[model samples]
Target: MLLNLYGIYGNFPLGKNDMIDNATQFGAAVASARKALGLTQRELALAINSGERFIVDLEAGKPTAQLGKALAAAKVVGLRLTATGTPQA
Candidate 1:
């Protein structure tokens, strides 16, 4: 099912499968949140103390991005990472 998230960016879809399962999803979510906040990629990078190229790579969903930097960027963009349910055996 699809959920609608209403925030400063208005309303956006939030589906169950929309979870950030990989770099591509992470990038898309970051980009969506950033745009919703009316921020440019460079602006977000600066806010997170990262480089513009890093932001570009991040938005492009590059899996090799530094974990620290990626987490920082997510925080700046108001993206929170959370895990639900128990681990599979």
Candidate 2:
């Protein structure tokens, strides 16, 4: 059984409740999840209707990466996201 840095097991379910403090960290997590799923950057990009460069830039932690596309990539790789914060009224 392979154990990843995020405590993922053989099935490579990816991170759980991982805190992403910045775009770079989120990109890293997305890359990890993509690799765990045995998906190439191009494959992930195609799946999300994006160009390979998008995946490359995203995985490289480009802060300007579009949120919608990035989120789509993350979702395709099974990276579940849960936003938590105090709601501003």
Query: Model 2's lDDT to the true fold?
Result: 0.78
Clashes of 2: 0
Which residue pairs overlap in candidate 1's backbone?
none
- lDDT against the true structure, per candidate, is 0.72, 0.78
* Candidate 2: segments with Cα more than 4 A from true spot: 1-10, 87-89
Error of 2 at 58 (Å): 0.5
lDDT string, candidate 2, 28-59, tens digits: 88888888888999999999999999999999
- Number of the top-ranking candidate, with TM-score as the measure: 2
The TM-score measured for candidate 1 stands at 0.76
Per-model C-alpha RMSD = 4.4, 6.2
lDDT of 1 by residue, 2-79 (tens): 222222333344443345567877777778888877899999989988789998998899999998998888777666
